[model samples]
Target: MAEKFDVIVVGAGMAGNAAAYTLAKAGVNVLQIERGEYAGSKNVQGGILYAQAVEALIPEFRESAPLERHIIEQRIWVLNDKSYIGTHFRSDNFNEERPNRYTLVRAQFDKWLNGEVKKAGATVITETTVLELLKDETGKVNGVRCDRENGEVRADCVILCDGVNALVGSRSGVRKEINSKEVALAVKEMHFLPRDVINERFNIQESEGVVIEILGTVTEGMLGTGFIYTNGESLSVGIGVIVSDLMKNRINPSTLLEKMKSHPSVAPLLKGSEVKEYSAHLLPEGGYDSVPELSGNGWMVCGDSAHLLNAIHREGSNMALTSGRLAAETYLELRDKGQPINAENLKKYNQKLENSFVLKDLKKYRRMPHIMLENKQFVTMYPDLLAGAAETLLRVDGVDKKTKEKKITKDFRSARGIFGLVGDAFKLVRAWR
Candidate 1:
């Protein structure tokens, strides 16, 4: 005899935990299977957790979760090889009682959430991998088959929340296989520093942190960005280049990260830090376009498996949580209404996603990836030009101000021929719209 469940959720990350928690609390028997030693053992994140999305699922998380800090400022830096032109936005309003976001270490945060799922009555089994979806003759998925012998376990529905890799989906022949262009390889390192050192370097007090997002030369002209995020006593610094770009440039993403840490503007902040942990993972960069059929038969997909990341905002955890919650909600609704899980009914998942920012924002930026790829100037010439223009104006040269203005204009025009410059500007403006 094989064990069975009302709902079986695979992967146990944010999405899996969210779905399991919701279903179990709603009185549905749910089983969660995780291949990691523990829930977050395989998890990796830059650690910005959006408060509103998470609080909706676990309202008291802040009271107990191991949070690093609350972000009160964000810096966007457009960099040249040796300089940066940037903008910083900081607000005291964010310091109020219910902060909008928090930085969390995935290893601790996911473990805590998994505990909550168990407390909500979900059966969680770790070190277990679901190899395939068991389907009946009618092509309806009835359960998942684990790696163990005779591991078939029946369930009304299965949620696939496996992070980023398309192992199950590719094997299932659901969507066209993911290609290099649809993904990005990101490498990150954790730097250990004392809490006071971190605060002083970023110019913040306890519990307040800053995030720096860098673009341009950081990716070696690849279509991606580099970032530095402050945690309580460590910093998360990383760089991601489109997998296609990585292959074409023949550059390892890890090498790009080392270059970023050594950047003149970036090095000073980490003058005395020690590297603590180094990890690399694939990020689904295909945006709205790469998402496959999210639901089929009795099986549904959420989180990275379905490519539910908002790469533009460096938002993955939030989407994972929201998608997981929506999946569980959809499941409960159908079960209460006595409907069998099938493609027709599961369409609700797609509809709900379309209504939310998950799909909408991706749609808005649908053209950005292609645009950036085609016009490499956005990553190379533009950043250098911005820095050069600023330097010319700010430097106290003996030359007249008019000469400086003319020199800046000439540099810009020569760097990006006048017509090309105008065309690039127009394309960028239109893409954002």
Candidate 2:
């Protein structure tokens, strides 16, 4: 005889832990399984946590969570070979009692979140792989088959929170295999530095942090971005590129990261730091069109497994946390009303998402990924042009101001003609709209 629970949450990542924690807190017999040695052993992120999402799940998270630093500054940089045009927003208002965002180590944060789940009465098993979903005679998913001997456990519903690869959902024919063109391959590193050194370099207090988001030639003409995040005593530096573009150009991701690190605008931040960790992970970059079926039979998918990534704004974990909470709330609502967890009833979950920011924001940016894919100028030619314009305007080399302005105009026309510039502008507006 196999054990049974009300729900089985797969993959103890952001989505899995959120669902399990929510369901277990509501007195549902939930069992969460993780294949890693611990909750966050395999998790990788750029390390920015949007507080509202987690605050909704665990109100007192700040009291015990392993948070690294509260972000008080944000920097955006567009780079050429030797120079970058950038903007910075730093506010003391962000240093409130309850900060809006924080930088964290994923492994530490996930482990802490899982601890909270266990405290809420969920049964968590690590080092266990859920091979596939077990379905009943009528094709309803009823449980999961794991690697352990005779390891079959029944459940009323199964929630797949698997990461971007989504092997479980793909293998069980629940969702299509991830498209390479719709995904990104990101490589990250943790560079350890002294806490005082970090604070001094970033020009911040002990509890404050800074985040830098980079675009332009750092990706080597690929559609991607680079980032640097501040932690307590280390820096999270990484670069990501679309997998399809990487394959098309045969560019090594590590090589690209190394080149970005050596850039004049980026190299100074880590002058004396020693790299302590290196990691790589896949991110869902397909935006709205790549999303698969949300629910069917007795199964529901959320987080990266459902392709719920907002690549335009670089947000994934917050969506994962919110989607997980909503999925659990949907189940609880149905259970309270004595409704069955079937394909028809689970449509409510999709409806809830549509009404929430998750789908609304994704829909708003639906055309962005396609636009970016079609316009290489946004990442390449524009940065060079902007840098050139800035230099030409600023360098007082005995040229008249009017003549310099004409030279700038000539450069723009030479690089991307008037019609090309107009078309690019139109495309950008359409995508944003």
Please list the C-alpha lDDT of all candidates, in the order they appear. 0.88, 0.93
Per-residue lDDT tens digits for candidate 1, residues 1-433, read 1878998999989999999999999989899999999999998888689998889898978898889999999999998889999999999998989899888889999999999999999999999888878888998988888887788899989898877886766666665667898898888899999999999989999899899998988888889998899999999988888899889989998888888888999999988999989988888888887888999888889988889887878888888999999999999889889998898999888888889888888888888777877888899888989999999999997989999999998998998789988899899988787
TM-score to true structure, per model:
0.98, 0.99
Please list the Cα RMSD from the true structure of every candidate, rounded to 1 decimal place.
1.2, 0.9
lDDT of 2 by residue, 122-196 (tens): 999999999899999999999999999988999999999988999889889898899988999999999999999
TM-score result, candidate 1:
0.98
Off by over 4 Å in 1: none
